[model samples]
Target: MNNYEQVLVALRRVIRATDLHSKRLSKTAGLTAPQLLIMQTIRDLGEVTIGTIADKVSLSQATVTIILDRLEQRELVYRVRSEKDKRKVHAHLTESGGSLLDRAPQALQEEFIRKYQNLQSWEQNMIISSLQRVAEMMDASGIDASPFLDVGPINRDHEWKNPTQRDDRKPDPASKLKAS
Candidate 1:
């Protein structure tokens, strides 16, 4: 294969690996990857608004709302109307939700996290910066730029390298090739 094709193939493999991991996590934990992610965010932020959760998870507000609905149905989470701003709603994990999170496996595959964590700090930073640069080259730079700016350096003190930080999964092969 040509260089470009080889890169595309590598990217597709990574995407497939992630998808397979997510599906396995869902089966084992009774929560889809996104649901586990949102639950973890709510646990970390403690009674955060829908928009905040969406931003944390790199998903749209509407998509978050739909996921919240499923979570609510399962009694894993509930929404509360803000007392001071009734129009605004915040999502909070139920007792069950917290327990679920405590027991649920991490969204990232164990093997992926293990390999990622073993990298030296500089190596980790380099990989992250390279990935971000590639995202920008692909015209996705603007999508999450505000978050990096709002929080200062994108990889501040290795925050982005945290194993617990929920990252968006790579696009499926069909979508990636179509974009290419």
Candidate 2:
């Protein structure tokens, strides 16, 4: 294969590895990578605002909020409005959240980062620069992505319903693609 094909295959393998680990993490800990990252941040920050969590994780506030909803449903976290500033809210891990965290395995990114940090400074810089170049080549520069590499839920079954056939929501571009 050519250099381009090799690089594409390598990238695909990396993505597949990340996706596989994410599924394993979900099965083992019952927490998505984003959810686990949020909980870890809460543990690190000791009561942090949702905005702070979003900033630290490189996700939008809206995305964080949606993840927070899932975590809250699982009883992993609770939000409290600031006493002095009711408009502001902070996230704290629940007792069970803390217990679960103690037993949870390290995230894939965390493992990679730990190993990366152990490398020489120059080596680290080289990898970062190369990855940045790759991102730019793919037109993904400045796109919002968490440090964590987990692709959200995987649907291996490809169990999808046609948009036009659905009883809910309006038809759009995806339906057109399906028709073709």
Candidate 3:
């Protein structure tokens, strides 16, 4: 195969791998990578705020709020306004959230990070440089992206197998909540 064809094949494999992992995660935990990361952060931090979650996961606060809204609708997470400061709200994982999180698999990026850390520094830098170059070649370098490895709309439920098939797992309405 030509060198450019080889590059295209490699890129396709990477995209396919990410897509497959995402499907596995949804099937197992009913949560996307970002959702799992946010929930894990919430569990670790013990009743944290959305801003804190956004910072921890390197996501926008608005995006975090939207995910929390879906989780809240699923009865997984709860939000409450602090009595001392009504403006400050906190997020806590409900019983269901904790249970689901306990059984959930690690996020795709977490697995990648684990393997990435083991590589020599030079190898890591080379990989970073190569990936950045590929992004530039694809005109995707200017895109704003979170660190999560998800591919679809983060706020929507996983699509059903067939477009004509009805899914009970409808997308939740986004709540204008400052927490959860």
RMSD of each: 13.9, 8.4, 8.5
- TM-score, each model? 0.60, 0.76, 0.85
lDDT of 2 by residue, 108-165 (tens): 8877888988999999999999889999999998876666777844211112233446
2 or 3, greater by TM-score? 3
Cα deviation at 71, candidate 2, in Å, is: 1.0
Q: Write the per-residue lDDT of candidate 1 for residues 14-130, one digit (tens) a residue.
A: 767766665566566666666777888899999799999888877778878988887887788999999999888999999988988898777664456689899999999998898
**Where does model 2 exceed 4 Å of error?**
153-180
Report the alpha-carbon TM-score of model 1 versus the true structure. Answer: 0.60
Query: Candidate 1 — number of clashing residue pairs?
Result: 0
Candidates 1 and 2 compared: the better one by lDDT is: 2
Model 1 residue runs over 4 Å out of place are 1-9, 109-180
Model 3 bad stretches (over 4 Å): 159-180
Quality of model 2 by C-alpha lDDT: 0.81
In candidate 2, what residue range of length 10 has the lowest lDDT sum?
153-162
